[model samples]
Target chain A: MLRIFIAITDNEPGVLDRLASTFRRRGFNIHSLTVSPTLDPAVSRFTLVTDLDDKAARAAKSFLERLVNIHSVADVTGTTPLLRDTVLLRVAATGATQAGLFQIANLFQAEVLDVGADSMVLAGSGSPERIEAFMTALRPYGLLEMGRTGAVAMQRCAAAASLETAVSF
Target chain B: MERPPQPPESASASASARAELPGAQIIWRCLEREGVDVVFGYPGGTILPTYDAMVDAKVRHVLARHEQGATHMADGYARASGRTGVVIATSGPGATNLVTGLATAMMDSVPLVAITGQVPSPLLGTDAFQEVDVTGVTIPITKHNYLVRDPRDIAPALREAFALARSGRPGPVLVDITKDAQTRAAVFDWEAAAPRRHLRHVPPPVPDDLLAKAAAMIQGSRRPLILAGHGITLSGAHRALAAFAEKAGIPVAATLLGLDAFPPGHPLFLGFMGMHGSPWTNLAIQEADLLIALGMRFDDRVTGDPATFAPHARKIHVEIDATEVGKNIPVDLALLGDLKDVLDRLEPRTPSLDTGAWLKDLDGMKALFDAPTWPRVRKGEGMSPVDVLKELQAQAPGAVMVSDVGQHQMWEAQVMRHQRPRTLITSGGLGTMGFALPAAIGAKIACPDAEVWAVAGDGGIQMNSQELMTLTQEGLKIGIAVLNNFNLGMVRQWQTHFYGDRRSASTLTISPDFPMLARAYGLRGALARTPGEAAAAIREARAADASTLIEFQVDPEASVYPLIPPGARIQDMIHEPPSQEAPC
Candidate 1:
């Protein structure tokens, strides 16, 4: 099973290296790790995916939090969360197949970014399931090359309780 | 005409408070304020500024031959004196050399503060000469670490480092200060910056329910056993633990590091337990109905297999660190607090129980497995390591024994009759070789009035034998006993049993003349070939005015008896000589 960890850390030169090396040290291979600047430029968010069991996930979460500059580590492995990815798919194309490719692209709500003599590039962004379906459809038309941005996730908020008074412990 | 600068009425009192000094000087001021009088370090280019600052500082700095030795010495000082030991080293290799020692301290939970010099902030990631990420390298091993790129942060970082090293479950902390920061000046206000005591982890209030639960277990236990650990000494709870043992009528079994925490001569003492521990102690643990663990983790050595360990015992762990409660072995209950503080609450609530049958059962096992007396060997015959240790124990009953990890260490732990806590200092958790020689130096420095002995196996003695030069330079009165078995004694023992006596690399075919090496370091040296000679050599070493070394030719095939082979049950002990007794 795949486990996803979202970590917030200070934007520093060695922070990424430190974070990446931590996974390696624990003998967990990072399947897909993506880092991007957050709303606050001083901080960055990292989405890391690894194949780990619940026990290893707990141990890794504790270790990641122990890193010097890591602000927080949340294991979003089993939450009703939003998952997304972006992919650029290039498939062999011609007038004979262009109409069919466009139909498939439209079906997945993808855009045909460019058209070459022999191939065309389709840019797609959606949930992991949608991306997988889009890629699977394009493969039948003779896919040339593909590039994907690994998933980013955020947990859905549950319904709020009564706010007349604060909850007491 | 330089009439000693008049003690300015107000200035003298607050000189350090208002002094604008270089960051390096401020570092020393913080150490001095923390009541640190000694430091062990090896100076290099990056850390030269702090070394230069030391000329005017009041702290005594012992120059270690290697950075590893410096860390071990600092560790020894901490364990012996119950204070945070300080160490300093330069960047890159100098800082890296302290890794082994840092890991050792981390394993044993010793309090140590290590200061390393880093490259200038501008050159940090450029792969500049002698630049390495000391903070990143030590993060996993250290309880906490800091990379101080700014001079203004130096004083506060050092203060925090000291507090972190000493608070809660104490362990090593590293502070990497940049070279540019060290040379820069900062106003070090000692009064304004108060060593961050407020930030220290406050010991939690004892839980009444947990105390009641433990007290109930004690009352209901038929064969109660108390497993004391180094935490008793670290928390100054030896007295409380001993009182609890006596009040509850419980027998106490010590881990290797727990030796002397409870007086070894006490009637309820069951000796140390672990991989190389006594068979009777292990048996007692197996038979115990209630095992009260204080300030000690259930390490793999002590617990052969966590699932099978203490199968009959209801274990209660009293530890400061919550993670250690169920780390290796499951505990029936956990009381998380400082051992001393928890004991203070639990001792009064604990009801004394009548456990005479349990005591009798344990005594019978002990008597059955007691070390049997062997026929005396003559002048030309090689002495057994156990016999040599027995003689040493008889001669120096109260001396502090610092042992290097190996067969001799086990022999010393098994044979020595320790009477008090903090008297037997050895690398228990890490089982570090080459620790004894330098650690004894630090121990002697910490306790000048006490007799200190560095007991090492032939393989271990050679690891840090260079520290003998440090001993001579300091003129410390210490004794060193080298159990010379001409092989890696412990590994050889395992090979003889498990590997069909292949021997392989266990034997040390050619080695240095240890006594001659001792003489080269300006110490009295002697060689003992037989039991009488070994005893005489020990006497001579003890009587010397300066530090001395005694090398004993121990029998090569003499293995630690009543061994529990790896992955074997605690009860399945292979008694000595293989043929003398069957596996119990």
Candidate 2:
């Protein structure tokens, strides 16, 4: 059961220590985590993917409920999302294999964002599940290089920032 | 400057000057607000200003021999008085020392407030001198923690710390404040207002539907039993448990920490159950048709084989922490709330004492109380732990007995009959080794006149044995009776049972010549080998001449028995008497 909640926060020294601390102290396991400052100069968002049981998950919610300054925690699993993510992957692109790779990308609605000799980059953004499924199909062609930007989800209908954030994170 | 003659408004001026202070002062003000009169602490470079300010603020500071002992004292204090214990220490080593104590408090649900002095603000990340991330070190152990970087957040941090410690599901809280914040002088308007918190609340009363469901279960059971845990005591509902037990005519067993929740001699009371528990209590719990577990988290020792334990019985668990409700051993009817409040509301609605068949079965088990199988006293040597505890009980009769981990702990738990709630203190969850001495110090602080005793093993005392100095410095007259078995009694028992007596690090030599240690701390000390010797030493300690320690030389192999080895079937137990060897 992997559930991710991305939190954006002010880049104070102890901020991440405190934010990540809530998870560590409560015995929650992190499956994957990515942290870096985005467009905001003084703020960084952490894409925290957690492997938590139902009770642990609820406890995680309660723990985060009282955090000091988290800007917002977005449960970006499923929603009409606006924020984008990039996974730069260069796979074997020999002439014979290139058509197969192109077909694979086209089938998954992925655009051929970049292509090079013996390699290609597939660019797409919707949800993590979409990117993951494409990555699984591409594995057979041998992914030569790989990079992934976690789901940087933004809510729809209004300014994405209008969604209530728990704290300055 | 043309002011009316300010008629010595110095005091008001002082109060007003402190009205807008930040971080460190914020914590201090919170302490003042919490009515903290005494603090146990040791200052290093990191915590100097807080120490200095505490002195000026008129908070009595007793320096501890070690940070570990300081927290234990606070744990003892909380157990004794139903108030949170406060311990202050410098960062790094100071914060690390508090981990085990905090873990122990969490396990037992004791309320504790630990304030650590951090390194200066600028040097926080470069592995600065005396700077260890105190919050990081204690993250897993504390109920919650705050790192105070901003001065304005101080008072609120403290308010939250204390509230978190003693609130729903009480545990330890640490407030790690930086040195710069401590020394910063600001307009210190400090109010320890915890009104900001909205999410945390005492669980509501057990619903009527739930109580009726539980009552129905009680009505249906043929051989029903009630097992009370520290939750009953924490909720201040021991009386409620008794009322329910008596009204329903059910037999009750207790966890180690649940001692005295039901009057020890009450007809409905069955002795404690676990690895070291009496045979009959274990047997009785096994035969129950319905089991009601209130406030107790069934630790592994209590439930030997989780799948097989109490198989025939339908279990009901009432716990405040949802984490504990179903973590181990399933509960048929699980209600989460404060024990006392839940039981009080449900008592009247429960059926009047009509389970005659069930009551009679437990009453028959109670007859086994007279025949305790253990190493008998070999006349005129020194005081047995049981006898010494009994004499201590006779004098302070209602005093809280705090114990260190070991054979002595089991003996005190068995012998000292506590007639009141929150009277017997032991590290049940963590089983921390050197808990008794400092805990007794805290216990004495909790109740100045209530006779407090530290019943410990020779090995258990040495772990934080340095607390003897803290006791003398604090000017507390606490009675200490060491059941000196010359080895770590519990560890030695394991070697005997499984490893064929191949002793390892369990045997401790160069024993703390306790009398010498006592005198070094400006206190009195004595050695006892016989029951009479124990009585005399206890009598002298009770005189309030000074804090005293009595070192008892007992047979080294005198193991605590009627042992139920872990994972073994209920009836398969070692009922052997301890080896009666010569005292060292």
Candidate 3:
């Protein structure tokens, strides 16, 4: 099963390497990982997707949390967290296919970032499933180039809580 | 010299009492504050500044022949003294040499702090001479590591490194300081530079529900066995383990590294268990109904094949590290906390069980399977490794034996009697060779009053034999026992069993005379070619006030018996050949 883990770690040099090394050393298969600065400048948040069973996932969480730089690690897969992946695609399109492409983009709520002489760049952000569907819908136009920010996740919160209070180490 | 005006006592007083010093001086000052009196290291270009500052530092520096030996010494020091061991080295190869030692410490959960000097900040990542990403290379091996480009971060980094090294599930931590960082002066405030309070990884409190579950399991178990591990020694829970075993009437079986955790001759002690472990103890584990695993990760060597390991047993893993609980063999219940604390809380709730029949059965198996009469030596053959270890055990009863990896290590584990925790220091986890001689130096340095002996095989002793000079230079009274069997005994044994005896590179076609080599280093040396001669040499080495090396020429074909073939079940153990004369 795929498990999503949200980790808050110290925003220091080599923190990313350490985090990645932890997963690699334990032979944990990471399907996707997204890391960015959090509201607290001193800390960074990571959204990691790994393929593991329930027990192995718990073991991975325990192992990652043991890193001194990591403040906390939470398995948010069961929480139905809002997961998003931003993808940019440049498709081979001519003026003849522009209208249809715009319509297809509109249907999926994707934005046309640029319109080239013979191609268009489209950007989309949504759940991985939606992203996959959007890519399938646009594949007929001939994708020239593509880039994606692997799935980042956030819990649907009922109230605001500080990072310190949200997780008990 | 005129005394400086004293600051008035106030909340800010400590903050104001700061000393302006270079990063290298700050390193020593922090170590002093951490109560580290000695460090094992070698000097190099990048680390020259620190070496120069050592003249003024109160800490004694033991110069090592190689960086690897230095790290092992620090590791041995940590294991013997129950304190964080410290090692310092230069960048690139120097730092890389510490890798094996660091991994060894990491595997056994030994607390160590490694300080390495990096290329100057400007030259970092530019492929400067002797420049390597030490921290990056050590990331997977170290519990945590720091690379300080700024002089101000030195004190805090060292403080944090020491704290983390000795914290929960202790392991090695590294601090790499750039040359410029070590040279530049900075304000050092011991109080202000203290590691954050939350840096400590405190294990959660033992849950009442888990204790209740464990207690219920114990009450229901008819043939429970306590699998005492290194954690008992690490957590100082030997007493608790014994108390719980006596209270519950469970036989205690120790892992290889866990040999000294429980006294060897205790009635409840079932002997060490794992690959090359005693047959009866392995059989007991296979037959037991409950296995209480404490402070030890179930390494592959211990559980031959996890699928067939303790088939009928419901394991209760009591560990400090949460990751180890279900990493190897799945456990029915996991009690997470310090072993001593967990055992103390669970002891009262544990109902005393009547396991008289179970104990009697185990005793019968032990008597039947463990009885091995010594084979009388033929006139021309050399002594056996067992005979040497037995004589050494009898002569140096209270000595701390630091063993190198391979056949001698296993034989020492099997033949020697360990009465106290931390007495037998060996490379259990990583199984690194050449660990004994240098590690024994570290152990002797850590426990000056205790007798320390380094026991290594012919192949292993040659790995770090140069450290004999360091042993003599430091004037440490360590006994070096080299079982010169003329081959890499363990590998040869494997070839003899599974590889059609195709020795390949296992045989040492040429090797040094270890006794002469020891003498060349200005140390006492002795050679023994028979059991009686080996006993006399061991007695003489014990009686000598100076460090002595005794070379015992043992049978090259002698193999560690009761061996479990790789991936084989414990019950499928291959005992010593029935036609051959038995080992003592």
**TM-score of every prediction relative to native:** 0.88, 0.86, 0.95
- Candidate 1 clashes: the total is 0
Interface RMSDs of all predictions?
11.0, 8.7, 7.5
- Stretches of candidate 3 off by over 4 Å are A158-164, A167-169, B1-17, B197-200, B370-380, B577-584
| CAPRI-style quality class for the chain A–B interface of candidate 3 | medium
RMSD of each: 6.2, 6.3, 4.0
Error of 2 at B521 (Å): 1.9
> What is the TM-score ranking, best to worst?
3, 1, 2
**Tens digits of per-residue lDDT for model 2 on A1-169?**
7666777665655666776777876678776677777566666767777877666665675556445345556665455455456676778787879999989888888889788887888876556777788889899898888877765555676535544333422
- On lDDT, the leading prediction is 3
Candidate 3 vs. true structure, TM-score: 0.95
Q: Measured by TM-score, how close is model 1 to the native structure?
A: 0.88
lDDT, model 1, position B281: 86
For model 1, the stretches where C-alpha displacement exceeds 4 angstroms are A4-23, A31-49, A62-156, A159-169, B1-20, B189-206, B371-381, B578-584
Best by TM-score: 3
Q: Which candidate's DockQ is highest?
A: 3
